[model samples]
Target chain A: MQKKSWNWNRFLACSEENMRNLQLQKLLERNSMSRSIEIERERETDGTKGCCKMEKGSSGYISEFLGSIPTFLRRCLFQVLSFGPIPHHIAFILDGNRRYARIHHLEAGMGHRYGFLALLSILKYCYELGVKYVTIYAFSIDNFKRKPDELQYLMDLILEKLEVVLSEENMVKQYGVKIDFLGNLKLFPEPIRKAAEKVMAATAQNNGTVLLVCVAYTSTDDIVHAIQGLYKEKQARIQQTAEGKQMGDDDEPVECSGGSNLEEFSVSSADLERHMYFAGYPDPDILIRSGGETRLSNFILWQSTFCLLNNPKALWPDISLWHLVWAILQYQRVRPFFEKKKRL
Target chain B: MGANRNGDDVTEINRIHLVGFFPNDLFQITSSWRLDIWNLVIRLCWFLLHQVFNTVHIMMGIKRVLESYFVPSGLLDEYKDLQLKKLRYLAVVVDSEEALQTLRIIKLLQWLSAIGVKHVSLYDMQGVLNKNKETILRSLSNSRLWEESHEKATFLNGGKMTLEFLSISDGREGIAKAASYLCSKYMKAKTLSGNQNERVFTESDVDIALKAVGCGGPEPDLLLIYGPARCHLGFPAWRMRYTELVHMGTLKSMKYGAVVKAIHKFLTVRQNYGK
Candidate 1:
C-alpha cells in the first residue's frame, strides 16, 4: 500500500512537470516567432524590388534612378553572400502559380504571367550570385490533364515569354543565359516546340549561365525515355555484332557470338544517366518548390536524390529574392550533413 | 528613396515598391563613398540574418525535444484511440548510423503500432535494419501484441501489423536493376520487329518491369525520415513521388509524442493528387 502511494505521488509530480514544459515551449515559440517576424518585416520593407521588375513604361529617369539604388544595394548583398558556398545548380518547382492567381482574383492565365516575371527576377538573382545553372519546371505532362482551354492559354503565354526571353533587351542577353528545354518536347504543340528550339539556338553561344526549362516533362518519363534510348542503342549494336559473327568463318561458335551477345548487355546507373535529357548538365544542388505543398509532384526524382528540398509558404508568383537567399542559406547549413552522407 | 547627388539629373526617382528593384534608367553605375557604406551595412545584415536562421534552427530542435516530453499522460491514451484512416502506408527511414540500435527501432515500431498504424516500411541507407529483419520479426511476433490472421483468439492492440524492411538497394539501385531487367525481357521480343519497338517506353511498362523484378513494394503515403538532414537517403524515387516526407530527428532521441504528432500531422494534411 505504501509503495502504491509512492508511485502515485511520482506520477502526480511528473504530470505537473510536463505541464510546465508544455507552457514553456509555447512561450518560447511565441517569443521566437514574434522576434523573427519583426526582423523579417524590417528586412523586407527596405529593398524588395530588384531589376526584375524594371518598369518599361514612361516612369521617367527619376523612378529608374530610385530602382537602381536598390539594385546597387542588392549587388552589394550578393557580393557578401558570395563569400559562402554558392550553389552551382539551383532548380525551381514552379508550383502555386495558378493558386496565386486564384487568391488574387486575377485572370485565368495571369498567374503564369506573374510566375514568368518571378522566374526572370530569380534568374537575375542567381546569375548575380554567380550560379551556373538554373532549371525551372515550366510545364508538366500531367498539367495537360487540365482543361484544353487552360492548356492552350498556357502555350500562348509560353510563346510570349519565349519572345520576351529571346529579345536582346532582356536578362537573356544581359546575363548570356543559354536556354535549353528539357523533357518530352514531342508532346507539345509544333509551334511551342519550334519556338523553344529557336530560343535554344539563339542563345547556344552564351556561356554565362544555362537556363533549362522543363516543359511537358516528368521525371518518370525521363527515366523511361532513357531506358528506351539505351534499349534501342543496345539492340542495334547487338545486331551489328551478330552480323559480324555470321560473316566470321570456320568453326567460330555463333551461340556465344564471340562474347558480344545480348546477354552481355549489362545496364548500370551511369549508362542510363547518359541517355537522360539533362545528361550533360550537373544535378541540381538545391530544389526550391515555391508553394505550401511539400511533395515533389513528379519533378526530377532521379536528379534530386541528395539536394536540399525547401518548401516556403510563399507561392511561386510571390517568391522573391528573399526566398531564393533563404533556400541557399538552408542549403549551406545542411552541407556538412550532405557531405557526411556522401562519404558514407 | 535614392539620393540625388548629381545636380545634372534633377528629377526625383519614381520606383515601384511591390516586386523588385529594376534600374530602368539609362544612367551607368557611378562609384561613390556612400555606396561603399551601403555595401558594408548589407554584408553585416547578411551575417546577422545567417546567424538568426541558425538560432531559429537550434531553437526548433530544443522546442521539439521539450515538446516531446510535454506530451501529457492523458494524450498517450488519446493517441491509441485515434482512428488513423488516411495513412494507408507509413515509412520510417533511419540514418545509417542510428539504424544499429535495434531496441530503439522496436520501440518506434511499438509506438507506431500503438497509434494504430496498419502498414509500415522501415528503411536505412546501409540495409542495417534489413540485416536484422529476422530478429525484429521474431521479437515483434513474440511480443504477442500482434497475432497472425489464423489465430483470432490471440491478439492485443493492432489487428495485424504489416512491416516492410527496406534499404538503398530497393531505391536508386533498384531502378538500375529494373532497367536491365526490362531491357533483357523486351530485347527478346524486339528481335521480331525492331522498327516497331523504337517508340519511347511508357510509365506503365516501367511499373510492370519493377513488379516483375520484385524490387520494392507499394509506395508509402507518409515517409518519416529519422536523420540529421532532411533527405530521403535514396528511398525509392518512384514510390516517393507524392509521399509526405517528415524528418523526425535521429533514432537515439526517438520520442513517442513526436511520432504521434507526426502521425497527427499526416492525418490532418489534405493530400491533393495533381490537383
Candidate 2:
C-alpha cells in the first residue's frame, strides 16, 4: 500500500551526484526477446476471453523506469543494498487477483493473468537481486473447489506456461533457473501433469536461481509428504533388528520383522527438514502476501515460523520494485532476532 | 514543487564538505557516505510506514468500540449482533510461547466468553496456555467444562463458550508421532501381506490415519494472533487451511475493540470456499 510509499527521490536524486561509473565491468543488457508473459491490459477492454498474453505485457507492476534505468545506477543501488543482509530465500503468497480485477472492472479471470504476470516480474527482480530461491503459492489444493469452468481455464493456462518454460527462448532457460513443481502433481489432469513433469525434467540441470511453483499444494499436505519422505529415507538407513539401532549408509540391507519393530523411529528436527519439499534450501527470510490480506491461507507454514510476513495493501498485480525493497529492509531489521531464535 | 524542493535539499546534503582531509581516498569515502545516507533514507521510510500502520490499527480499534457503543446496552455482552452469528470457531494465537502470561490468558478467555464465542482454541508454541488451562478455566462462572481433555464449554449469561487448548505438541510434534505410528503400521502391514513392493502413503492416507488416532481437527474460521509476530507460531497446520489470520498486536496491549473489529472484518470478507 501507500504505507511504504515514501519518496525514493532522495535516494534516486542522491545517486545522480555519486553516479560516476563505479562498476563499468559489464552492464547487463535488457533482453529484447519476447517476455514469457505479456499482459495485454488493453485487450481486456475488447471483451476478449481471459487468457495468457503471448506478446510482451506492459503492466503497471513492471515499472518502465526500473527496466530502462541506466544499468550502472541499478547496479550501484544493488551494490549499496548488498552491503546489508540480502535474504537467501523469499516466498510469496499471490493473493487479491480477483479483487484487483473487480476494483479495476476487468473481465472475469483476467485478474489471474495479471497475477501471473506480476509473479514473473517479481521473480526476475528476486533472482537478479541474488536471492537463491523464490517459491510461489501458485495453485492450492483447495482451489479444486472452484467452478469446473474456471478450473479448466486455470489448468489450460498452467499447461501453456509449462510448455513455454520448456522452450529454449523462455526466461527459465535463459537464466538457467531450476523450476520445481511442488504439491500433489497427481491431482492435475493428464495433459497438465505431463507438461509439469516435462518442464521440471527440462530445468532439472539448471544451476542458477530456483523457482518452486506450488500447484495443488497445501502446507499440511507438504508436511505429511515430508514425513512420508523422511520415513522412507530413514527406513533405508535404519535397521529393523530386535533392537532399534542406527545403521551406516554402506551397511548391508538387513531384513527383519519390518512392521513390528518400526515404532521407535522419531524424527529429530534435522531429519524432517532434509525431507521437506524445500530441502537443501534455507527457510525464507521474508514472505510477502500482497492482496491487502494478512492471512497465510495455508501457505509455507513450517518454513515461515520466523519469516517476516508482509501483507502489503497492494494487490498481487500491483506489486512493484519498491514493495520488494521495503520487504528486504524490514527483513534486515528483524533478522537478528530470528537468527538468535534459530541458534537457540 | 514541494517534492522538487526536498529533492534539491537532499542533493545538497549528499555532498561532502570536509573532503580535503582525505584527498586520495575521497572517492572511497564519498561512496561509503552516500551508501550510508541511502540506508538511512530507506530505514526512515520503513520507520514511517510502521508508524502509519500503528495509527491505522489504533483508529480501527476506536471504530470498533464506537460501533459497540451504538448497539443496545447489553447486546454486545449478549452477542446478539447478526454479524457474529456465523462464527462457529475462533482461535487465539499468542507469540509468547515461553513465559506463561496467566492473567493475560484468563482475561482473554473472559473477553472471548463475553463475546459469546462458543468454540475457542488457545495456541502457544510452548504449551504455556495448555499448562495453565485448568487455572484459566476455574475463573469462569457456570462454565460447563467439556468432556474432552482439551475442550471446555462455559455457559455464562445465557451465552455458551467452548474452549480448546493447543500447543506445539498438538501440531508438528503430534503429527510426527502419528507419522511414526503410521510408518510402523505400514511396515507391519506389508510384512503381513508378504508384499515386497513399496507402498507410498498419500496425504489422504495420513489424514485417515490421523483421524483413526484422533490427531487432526476441523479448520477454524478465524485465527486472531496476539503478538508482534504475524506468524501462526506453529499452531497446527492441518487445522488452519482456510483460517483467516489477523494480527492484533501483543497480548499485553490487547484490546476488546480490536478483537471485535477483527471479527467484524472477517465476517465482511468475501470467503470463496473452493471446497
Candidate 3:
C-alpha cells in the first residue's frame, strides 16, 4: 500500500523520543543563544494545545448557518479578510500544455489554446484577488531549442494569442491589462515579434493589471540586458552631461544633463529594480508554478525576495479558478509575514 | 562540500528550503485544546522539518537532473568583475501590529550583527498598534540587542515615527519635521526614533529619510529578511536598490544555521545572472 511508505510507527521507532530530542538539542546548539531561546519558546508555546469548545445549544444556529453557506462563499470571506498577503508578485511557469493535450487526446495546438483560455480566466481571478502583478512564463529561452516543427507550432500558437488580444472576443480589452513582453524578442521569428508588438501597443493604455509574457525569457538573459541597458543609459547620460558642461549653459534645466549609471556610483536595491525589465511594477507577491513542480526554473531573480510561492499539483492547462483560489488561500495563511516585512 | 557551480560559479553549499506551514481547521486535530498547544507545536515543527527535508531532497534531485541534462558553462566574462558592493542600506518596511514580531526579529538582527552585518533600518508602514511609548521602551529594554547597542547604535527607534508621520504623508513633510526636530532637540543630525515609517536618521535632510541609513560601504554584503512575500513593498527603495535580498522565508521558518549558511554562501559565492 502507498501507506507503507508513510508508516508513522516505523518512522518513530527508527529514533526513540529521547534520541529525537537529543538530535533537536544538537541542532539547537548550532544556533545563536537568543535564537535558540526564541526557538525553544516557540516550540514550548506551540507544543501547548488550545481548544475553544463552545456549548452545543445556543451556538448551534451559527454553526448551522455557516455550514449552509456555500464553501466557495466561505472561502471568499476568508480571502477578503486575509487579502492574500504573500506572493505580491507571482510568476507562472505555464508548463504541461502538450501533456495536457495528450492527456485529453486533443490536437497539438488545442492544448496551447486551452492554456491561453485558462490564462485569461486566471488573470481575471488574480486581479479580483488583489494580486498586483503576474508574469506568465509562456515560453522559455530554452524552449526555442525544441524540435523545429514543435517550435514553429508554439510560435504560431503565441501569435494566435497575440492576435486574440485585438479580437473583440478577447478579454484584454475588457480587462484593460497592460501586456509587456520579457525575453529576447529578437530571438523570436519576425511574425511572432510583430504580433507581440501589436498586442503590447494595443494594451499600452490600460493599467488595471500588468501581464508580463515571458516568451523567450530566461532570468540570466534578463539580467544581462538590464545591465547592458544600464550601461548604455549611463554612457549617454555622461555624454549629455559632458556636452552640457562644455557648452557652459546651466539654464537648460539639470534634467537635460541628467546622469544615468549614477546607481553604479552608488547602487541600492531600488536602483536594481529600476534597471530591471519590469521596473515601476511591483515584484511578484505570489509565485504560482503548476505541474507539481516546486522549483522556480529561473523566473524573477532579484525581484522575488519575500514572495509567497504556491505550487498546486495541477498542470498549466488544468489551472482553474480553484487552483488560483487555493494559491491565494495559501498566501492568506502567511499574511502576517508580508505585513511585518512591509514595514521594512 | 560540493558547491553549486552554476551560472555565476556560486557554490551549492547553501540549501534553501522555502516551506510554509499554515494553521487551518484541520490544525485543530492536533491542537484544539489549550493544553495540547505545546504538543501540537512540536508536531507542527516536526511536520515543518519533514517538509523542509522533502524540499531539500527535491532540490537535490532537480540539481542532479539539470547537471545531467546541461553542459558546464563558464561564467559571463563581462559581469565577472561586477562589484555590486556599492549597494547597501536596508530599510525593512513592515505592518504595525506584526511589529510585535520585532522582539523576535531583534534576536535575528543580533545574530545578523554578530555575523558582521551592519546597518539595518526598520520601518513600520502600517500603524496597527497604539501602545504606550513607555511600555514599548520597556519591551525594547528587555531585548539583548537593545542592551548591547552603544549610544550610536540604534535599531528600535524608528517604528512609531514611520507609522504616524512618514508612511502615509509619503516621507516628505513628516521627515522634514522629524529632521528639524532631531537637529534642534537632540542636537544630532541622525537621532533615531522608534517605530515609524521614517525610523533611523542619518542626516538632517528629509530626502535621506528615503535613503538607507547604513548597510552600505566598500564591502559587498546582503540584506537578509524574514517576511511573508518576496516584494520589498514600499521599503524606502532608495536604500535597498541593489541589495542582494535573501528571504529567510517567514519569521517562524527562520533558523540561525540558515542565516549563517546564507551569509556564508553570499560572501563566498559569485553571482552571474546572465551568461
lDDT winner = 1
Model 1 bad stretches (over 4 Å): A1-66, A169-174, A247-260, B1-49, B62-83, B142-158, B192-200
- Model 1, B184-254: lDDT tens digits are 76675565454464555788888987877777467788989887767777788878877887878788777
TM-score, B chain alone, candidates in order: 0.72, 0.68, 0.38
Which CAPRI quality tier does the interface of model 3 achieve?
incorrect
lDDT per residue for candidate 2 within A261-299, as digits (tens), equals 465655554666677777777777889988777667778
Point to the candidate with the largest TM-score: 1
Write down the TM-score for model 1: 0.77
Model 2, range B106-155, lDDT digits (tens) per residue? 77778777766777888877777777878877887635343352432223
What TM-score would chain A of each candidate receive against the reference chain A? 0.78, 0.73, 0.68
**Model 3 spans with C-alpha error above 4 angstroms:** A1-89, A105-109, A169-171, A249-267, B1-275
lDDT of each: 0.72, 0.67, 0.50
Instruction: Give candidate 1's chain B TM-score.
Output: 0.72
Best by DockQ: 2
Cα RMSD (Å) per model?
Answer: 16.2, 11.1, 23.0
After best superposition, candidate 3 residue B50: deviation in angstroms? 23
**Model 3, range B6-70, lDDT digits (tens) per residue?**
32211111110000012333333443253245333433443453355457646964664443233
